[model samples]
Target: MKAAGILTLIGCLVTGAESKIYTRCKLAKIFSRAGLDNYWGFSLGNWICMAYYESGYNTTAQRVLDDGSIDYGIFQINSFTWCRHGKLQENNHCHVACSALITDDLTDAIICARKIVKETQGMNYWQGWKKHCEGRDLSDWKKGCEVS
Candidate 1:
């Protein structure tokens, strides 16, 4: 049993680099405190729904886009534009490294996401928002999550 536990720990260290997948309510509470609720006319539900569809609340999620740009973190922020990945020239409008977006600390991610919304003037920057959340009743996203 001790050997098994050690192997599991080794496996996690080898395969997962600081990954944290948050439950909806827990993330909702965190986001609420981040002032995501009703931010720029987007309700907390919209933010919750976006987090779900973007990365399933995974803090270290990553996806490579068709154009070879990468999306990182719960927001799946693009590397080509919003952040610097240290590989190529990036717009880096948010002045954050893409690596910063994938850590357990969400401060960088949330700040960058807000900048994206502010620059785009809405949630249209995220396809997830356009498809799964737009014009939809997203009230249940934060329903049972008592966020004060």
Candidate 2:
């Protein structure tokens, strides 16, 4: 009976873990189709994780500041700054968010992110995600996104 119970618990845990990855994979397709995949070089897996950390992938995400301005979009661009990089739109603009990511050069966001990952988290930090999401198929990303 003890061995059977342990096996059941492990099976349940594995199922839950698989479900989470399925959800993240769906979200990855949305972000990739929206233009973020063009300007960002990180893996869709990593980008989905970052979006979860930043704003739960909410496109209408916004933050209010003491100065009374609004920040908008999935990657969270301040209204004042959005105009500098992208077109104005009633709805959040994914293209603008993508452009802002390339602030200095086309590859700036990816290179900068790698540098940050190294400086703050140390080298090989991305290995952590592989451990966390072990056994998940990230290769499905190619079907959903067109690389720039």
Candidate 3:
């Protein structure tokens, strides 16, 4: 019984390290510091909305596509074009592993997302942005946040 209890505690600890869901204001502050607040004319609200739709602000979100490609992290960056997954050949413009994006630390994810935005049609690379964040009044995304 003692050993079983230890194992359960270890499992809980491991699961706790896997993912984190961030609040909107917390994300806004982080994104602002990263210069994503108005980068490429997209407001902070756009990014907030995108993150919500993509992974619900969860850092450990990952999805395997029908094409065998996988998307990782809050932004759901694709392995096929952005990051390398296992033995697959990838462009890897961000030069980071797909696994790196899934951590609670979002530094790698934000860096990779910036690269994707610069290379592609801005935030259009993310379908979530187009479907949810595009051309809408996004002032409410950062409404009460003191991000400066």
Candidate 4:
């Protein structure tokens, strides 16, 4: 029984590690429905471009930073200021577990992202956006994705 339980837990962990990488159009629709299409004066294309640069649209993507803080999920929300991982001190403005960001469901990520935008310098909070999506014609990001 113990071995069975251990195997089950391992299976679950392995499954969790696998991320869902959304297609650009698919993500555009999702973000549009979530009101992120033009939120904070940025287009849905900007969000899509940012997600690609941040996590390649992989929900389970996580990167441990040089400062020991982890960026989680497709948007790569950070542990240092946005989320709490384990017992680490965090600002936790998102009011969610860092683990929550890495799930297939992006509801929490979208909600937290909204909070970050409202509190900080809008989409500029994501360096990915500034580097790739800003000051560029991002129409190709959602070119054929009719997000109605």
Q: Which one wins on lDDT?
A: 1
Q: Tell me how many clashing residue pairs each candidate has.
A: 0, 0, 0, 0
Q: Which runs in model 2 stand beyond 4 Å of their true positions? A: 1-23, 34-40, 84-148
Query: How well does model 4 score by local distance difference test?
Result: 0.89
- TM-scores for every candidate against the unseen true structure: 0.88, 0.37, 0.87, 0.87
Q: Give the Cα lDDT of each candidate.
A: 0.91, 0.44, 0.88, 0.89
The digit string of per-residue lDDT tens for model 1 on 72-91 reads 99999999999998769989
Please provide, for model 4 over 5-112, each residue's C-alpha lDDT reduced to its tens digit, 9 standing for 90 to 100: 998678558546666889888999899999997898888888899999999998988887999999999999999899878898898988899989999899999999
Give me the overall lDDT of model 3.
0.88
Score residue 84 of candidate 2 by CA lDDT. Answer: 35
Off by over 4 Å in 3: 1-17
Against the true structure, candidate 2 reaches a TM-score of: 0.37
Give the range of the ten consecutive residues with the poorest summed lDDT in model 1: 8-17
Worst 10 residues of 2 by lDDT: 14-23
The alpha-carbon lDDT assigned to residue 15 of candidate 4 equals 45
Error of model 1, residue 143, in angstroms:
0.9
Query: On residues 31-100, what C-alpha lDDT tens digit does candidate 3 reach at each position?
Result: 9989998888888999999999999998877787999898988999999988887888987888898888
